[model samples]
Target: MLIKSVFIILLVGLFCQTSYAKDNCPTRKPVICYWASWAVYRPGQGAHKIENIDPSYCTHIIYTFAGIDMDGKLTSLDNHNDIVNGGYKKIVALKESNPCLKVMLAIGGWNEGSEKYSLLAETEESRKKFAEDVSRLMINYGFDGFDVDWEYPTQRGGIPADKENFVALLRALKERLKPRNRILSIAVSASVAVSKQAYDIEAICREIDFVSLMGYDMQATNATSIHSPLKLESSDPDDRETLDQIVYYYKSQGCPTQKIILGVPAYGRSFTLQNPQNNHVGAAVLGVGREGTFTREAGFLGYNEICDLKRTRSDWRNEYLERNAAVYGSINKLWVSYDDPKTIVAKAQYVLEENLGGMMIWSIDTDDFKGRCGQSAYPLLQAINKGLGNQLPSSFSHVDF
Candidate 1:
């Protein structure tokens, strides 16, 4: 009778665990998805509204960009969309569907620059005031917390003191958020060159809930290269720019495994080939590729647009780079290096292998959320969830950084 009871208890526990895994598709890893507010302006099928978001797909959905006012207070950059239209309340309402969802807001993007943030962090009084103001916004708007996206604190017209001061600012913000149990995260550059100059990783990690590492954009060159390669080849000149290198760098610098959130792009980086025949990885480029029909960005192509190209264009062809674990598609003189489901799966597997926090998509809006690709709505995002739920073999090992 004792043995039978023990057996029954074990079976019940196993059944419950299996049920939890199936019900929670993404398992324990958080899928942090950034929702760019401007994506609503994207024409036709590309236009993604706050309602389009499926809160179940993401653990945390951050509203991109609230900015610092000249007076050093938190302010909305888009009053019409963010405030007048009740964007904040609508986004927070997503928690109604998935109570586990953390709706966060980001302040400072590439356009927001670093000068004002540097100034805002120079004094304790200003930092405290800014934190209080941010806390107020979080409380008022029902945001879980805010993300500090100061693009390279000590670079791009910022004072050198920003490196340490950035830490101070985060500490103050964390203090304000901690009492209320709100989250505090920062989007940081993945490049070793920029990271070393801009951040003291150890110090920053100590104060924040997590670090959103912008692992893409390592392909800033005249030649064609993968924008967000998963792994680095020893022969590659920019090996330090790969996702593996950045993750390793942060880990080496004492960032906890759970505190590092690796980022992946929902868009691809494009280049206009100088010679149509020389369409290889290092092929010379004339300039940025033609803009997408919907995104209308000269050098970038959203995953949705890429799907359109694959479906509509007869000449479109793709080649996989096994070494880097990335893919590139070419049509005539236009060449784009981008991530598809395969790439995302590999990265997700890496996240699991490393026991990292989770995966973050740059902007969820750019993903194919309309099912126009004949696969599924939000195909890339679905792939991320799928990968995160996968169980790799015991023999699987991570590549050397």
Candidate 2:
């Protein structure tokens, strides 16, 4: 109960400090960048301009690992060898180019899923082993820290006991890695219940350096009719990004205010439902993604795809609801939810207004700057930095067109 009381006190302090901040820096906001090494090094992908990344726009570069190939057993330390040697090379190069940029390793992706995590979290030895592997991996690589992105803690396919086990895992991680002083983070769902169930916010904040709120994917594919935007509209059902409410929940639970990172999707999803004409279609059979270039079960599209769609009348964009920004095209009947430079700007502004730790893109690769889409991720970052950062107007003059 005392822990609960302390949590309330922290919440009170959070509100008082945020709403009345005199400094320009958002005291409670997070500054972040999502970097997927594999995606970045694809043929004619992020590599063409990997060196062109602007560090001023972001404070941290989160490196994602897709795991080792099926050949030899992969040690946690060198599991993601391919991405590092090939794709992440450019990432490391960027760091060499910009000393201020910080890189952290993200484990387990949507495809990789969290099937094995339940087994890993079932016992103390497994949890410790996992943490050791993560710590060793970060040190072995040039990474600054680790972000545990186990999709679900208890719901869906996740293990039922992982709710409390997650906190225990983090506690062990904090104790072990404290000496090394590595950055610790977790990719948690936006759901209030899930966050509450998975980890102790206050305890996690104490151990991990920051918490990246995986804010995207709030939309559901359930049969019920729904109009969920990646960035929910103010009018949507209990879905608006109301700062006071969100912060209240976190602070009340003892989560630290300074280490919160808001997650935003750089790209959108085009959902192919059973009916094309129905605006209230449910579920995503396939993705008529950005620019109609690809379709998978809720697969992602790059910023380039969106840009191309804008020009080519991509089916995904053809029937998008102008008001809700929902995509409703394709004869198969599709509805998509994604973010562009414009929407990205709105969320970035929200970060500033709310004094959140800062924002992190779902991935750096999704932000295509080659004009594939109408806009690029770089400009979006620039907008965020300009909006929330201490950027001066004179700095823009030095940037090459």
Best-matching candidate per TM-score: 1
Q: Write the per-residue lDDT of candidate 1 for residues 235-280, one digit (tens) a residue.
A: 5784447888889999999999999998999999999999999998
Q: In model 1, how large is the Cα lDDT of residue 279?
A: 91
Alpha-carbon runs more than 4 Å astray in model 1: 1-27, 238-240, 390-401
264-355 per-residue lDDT for model 2 (tens digits): 66665555555555545454344333333421224355555555555666344344333343343333354555555555666666666666
Candidate 1 clash pair list: none
What CA RMSD would candidate 2 show?
A: 11.7
Give me the runs in candidate 2 sitting further than 4 Å from their true place: 1-30, 40-54, 66-90, 222-235, 238-248, 273-299, 314-335, 372-377, 390-401
Could you tell me the lDDT of residue 281 within candidate 2?
41
RMSD of each: 8.0, 11.7
Task: State residue 328's C-alpha deviation in candidate 1, in Å.
Answer: 0.4
